[model samples]
Target: MYLPPHFKIDELAAIHAAMQGSRLATLVTATTDGLIGTPLPLILDPREGDYGTLYGHVARPNPQWKLPPTGEAMAIFTGPDAYVTPSWYATKAEHGKVVPTWNYLAVHAYGAVEFFEDADRLLDVVTRLTDLHERSRAEAWQVSDAPADFIRAQLRGIVGLKMPITRLDAKKKMSQNRKAEDRAGVIAGLGASDDPVDREVAAMIPME
Candidate 1:
């Protein structure tokens, strides 16, 4: 994350919000073989530690859980992102120096990777993750909705993950580096875009 000073997101609340809203994350670890990465949905538990811990599980057969990570692992969470065209910048007309860029938010969490297969811990992680994602639905599903035997059987196929985040690097690049007129132009252009993500990105751009 090569973030310039103007593009950095220092607010912990803002970073946490982005992390919580992201369902999928990329987990990276350095191993003797090389850098191994896994894309999965992680559950963030702020109560677990100072910076919060990530919880998830990988298929029991997935080699990532079996790898020996030499140091801390990294979990990446990406938020709303959109392509910004040069035509959207007021500077393009003023100085013809504008270029395309991306407006997005992301968080990188680093910590020791811990793997476990205990039934109790696995159940706890799965139940909490399910509840977190299902709470907003009208007919929310639950682990209890299925038979205990079936759920137990399913749990056996996966191993749990617990990463206590030791470092957090967050970035929110929303035209903060551009001039006010250029930023306003970008917002207007993005707000009218065909992609819903562009509209969301437009709304996130801070008013200068």
Candidate 2:
């Protein structure tokens, strides 16, 4: 994460919020075989460590969990993002020097990874993960809604992961480097875009 001072996210609350909002994340590790990555959903336990802890699972067939990481593993979480056209910058008309860029939020968490197969811990991780995502649905679902034997069998096919975060790097590249008027122009352009995600990114840009 190459974070310029203007775009760095220093607040822990903001960093955690961005991580929690991301539905999917990429977990990457370096092993003797080389680098391996998996995309998965993770739940954060903010109270678990100095930074936090992440919980998730991988399919039993996935080899990522079986490999021993060389050092720390990294999890990448991404938030709303939108492509910014130079045409949206007010300065483009003045000097024709502006270039296109992207506006987005991202967080990288590093920790010593732990893979576990204990049924009890796996059950707890899945239950909490399920509840986290299902809570917002009108008709929420629960692990208990399924038959006990079925749920137990399902858990057997996956391996649970725990990572107590040792480092966190967060960035919010939301047109903060642009001039005030240029940023306003970007906001106006993005707010009028057909993509709802563009509008979401527009709203995140600070007016100042």
**Candidate 1 C-alpha RMSD relative to the actual structure:** 0.9
- Best-fitting candidate, scored by TM-score: 2
| Per-residue alpha-carbon lDDT of candidate 1 for residues 108-176, written as tens digits (9 for 90 to 100) | 999999999999999999999899989999999999999999999999999999999998999999999
- Cα deviation of 68 in candidate 2 (Å)? 0.6
Residue 30, model 2, lDDT: 97
Candidate 2 lDDT by residue in tens digits, 129-198: 9999999999999999999999999999999999999999999999998989999999999999999999
Ten consecutive residues with minimal summed lDDT in candidate 1? 7-16
TM-score of each: 0.97, 0.99
Off by over 4 Å in 2: none
Best by lDDT: 2
| C-alpha lDDT of residue 206 in model 2 | 96
Which stretches of model 1 miss by more than 4 angstroms? none
